[model samples]
Target: MSTLTIIWIALPFFVGFISYLLPRFDRIFSLGVAIASTGYALWLYTQPPLKLQLLDNFGVTLLLDPLSGFFILTNGLVTAAVILYCWNSGKTAFFYMQTIILNGSVNAAFACTDFISLYVALEVISIAAFLLIAYPRTDRAIWVSLRYLFTSNVAMLFYLVGAVLVYKASHSFAFAGLRESPPEALALIFLGLLVKGGIFVSGLWLPLTHSESETPVSAMLSGAVVKAGVLPLVRCALLVPEVDPLIRGLGVGTALLGVGYAVFEKDTKRMLAFHTVSQLGFILAAPEVGGFYALTHGLVKSALFLIAGVLPSRNLKELQHQPIHTPIWIALVIASFSISGFPLLSGFGAKVLTMKSLLPWQVIGMNTAALGTAISFAKLIFLPHQKQEKQGKIQPGFWAAIALLIGGLFLANIAYYEAYSFENIIKPLATIALGWLAYFLIFRQTTVKLPRLLEQFDHLIGVMSLMLILLFWMVLA
Candidate 1:
């Protein structure tokens, strides 16, 4: 089982190499490799000691525990969706690069249990992400990729320093062993994971990088890759007994930050990107409060990212200007509503779970997040001017997938107590209402300008994160 899992991790890279050698059939290569990898992951999950040692002394290990299985499945689903969407769109050599990198990294990430292995997997994903974003060689893509690299590298530095501090204390890289180490060492580990997990203020790189990517790439990055960071964070939160407060605080801060950026974001994709941060903040806050809440949020967010890519409108102007005659257009609206947390949708369920689990402070954190998302997506109302089209129906297969996922999300929210609660129902609705009201108050008028002070908010947050690291060092001293 372990060997199979490792092969699953390596499969994408092997296929990617082949694709590179034969770039003429990139789309076919992408789809075949993705499907095969997904199958391998599923098979690996079904058979297991649940743990496998890859390099025993080197502290490299693989795990196919329940948590890892869930993440792998999510990654597979989202990646498959993205690959399917790219079928009609012309393929570039970069598509193969992005797909291969995304698959290999995500597979390696979920399977690996050692800190060093996880770090290596994450770096693999990060480097590929930089290429995908900047592949067009356009000025915008180059600028965004550079910004992403700069911010992510800084985060990586902090993560590495924390890891070294942890190694000095624990002397082992395995998560289980690390958890058994001194409390101080465990704290350092959490700090490192927090940076990787895209915690609120420290995760500013997420919005800028993801929102700026091409639509398909944006879907893959937001829906699938960012969560590579998230899965580890979730695992860390679960393993470290004393990290609850710190993680929750980070969650609240991230949620607020995401909302703030989304509120003022002018582009549709950028707005969704900011919302990704806020939504992730909600997911992070969930497990800290206890229960299986994060899973639903993770699944729903993946779907949302894919939906955002497939939707006809690219931006606010396009949405408003484009004639909504196609069946795909309707599906897009359903998807948009679902993501924005319309009642009875999958998002509502996730939001409910979060609200039910949250303390007042946490609730406040998520409410602000929802409000920001609502405002940002509201910008979509202005989707650009295009020639009108009579509404034409879409293919059954596409609509079927959307409907099925939406329905599943609803069922998971309503039927599964481990993931849902009556308490969740009340708070999520309240948050949704508050979000809607906030959108009306702040975003209804297109002229509302965010303070210039907040324009460089990413830089400010990064500096503050640096300060936090310094403070952590001082406290340890």
Candidate 2:
């Protein structure tokens, strides 16, 4: 098991490095590696959970429990999808290399049990992501990537400080030791995770980065990478269940704000990016359900971003004039519905399970977000004013990704039938209906202008810092 774990972690990095040397066949080689890696991860699921100790004195370890195992598998699937999508996109060898390294780093982050290991994995992911975001080399891309690099470093500072504080008190870097640390350290840690997790204010860098990046990169950023932060937060929640309510409240706030901004967004990718934050709210409020939600969202959101990339225009009004490919449209519709909590879909199942234990206010907030999602996505169904020539053939890899995502949506409901009942499906159906109705009655003809505060990085960082202070006070008080 330890050997297998090591192989899984190191395979991508090795392949990535080798691919750089074989530039002509980089795409083919990376694709093959992705497929094999994903297959191996799935195979690992059949075996019992495993814990491997890589270092004795330094406490370096990898624990593949149910939570980490699920995330690892999901990461593998998404990485394969990303590689496939990029296979024919004419990217350079360096792009392929970075993608592979990014996948390995995320997998390592998921598998690591110690804080130091997790931090190192996260930093690798951050560096890879920064490079990927800047891969386009456009002025805007460089600016956005730089902003992400700076903000993430600041967030890491918070995490390091918190880790240091925890080590000082507990004298260990493992989660078990950190369980006894002070609330101040925990609050600092949560703040950093929230930043990386793409929570509204804390994750202010998300929208710009997700909206501006290359299609495949955007998919990975929104889908798999952001979850790296949430994984640790889930661990923290386990250590301190008392903070669940605080986390839930912050999640609700992030969700509502995300929907609010998404409702007014005109750029197709930007709207989807905001919805990422909103969906994350649901996950934070219910980590158990979050696993399924994150998995479903990662797949669906990646597909949507890819579809957006192929579109002639990203503006909703302009999109209504361009002829869209049938498979792309089908995938887009399914993904939109999945995110909006249509009954019998992945999002619906996750929402049902998440709401089962929520407070009334939280339930109301979630339903409202659902309604907002429905209203916001309604624009997608609008047909072009004039029919035009269909776009180029959709890639086989993209089609495969869509199919897998749709399958995951169905499986989320079927596999979790023990937690999902017929009664549980009712609310989401009603919510969807209400959302469409509201869209028709009100938002269809009107557009609200958002302040576009996210683009102002300085303001966002200040606000994020204030929120962290408030969180510390709330937790310590």
Name the best candidate (by TM-score): 2
- In the order shown, what is each candidate's alpha-carbon RMSD? 4.3, 2.1
Estimate the TM-score of every prediction: 0.82, 0.94
Instruction: Give one digit per residue, the lDDT tens place, for model 2 in 359-422.
Output: 6768778778878888888766553433346547555567666666577678756766665567
Model 2 alpha-carbon drift over 4 Å, by segment: 359-361, 383-397, 418-420
Assess the local accuracy of residue 434 in candidate 1 as a C-alpha lDDT between 0 and 100.
Answer: 69
The CA lDDT at 416 in model 1 is 43
Per-residue lDDT over 164-247 for candidate 1, one digit per residue giving the tens place of the 0 to 100 score: 656776676776665555554544555445555565555655666776687667767776677777777666667765555556
- Estimate every model's Cα lDDT from 0 to 1: 0.63, 0.79
TM-score of 2: 0.94
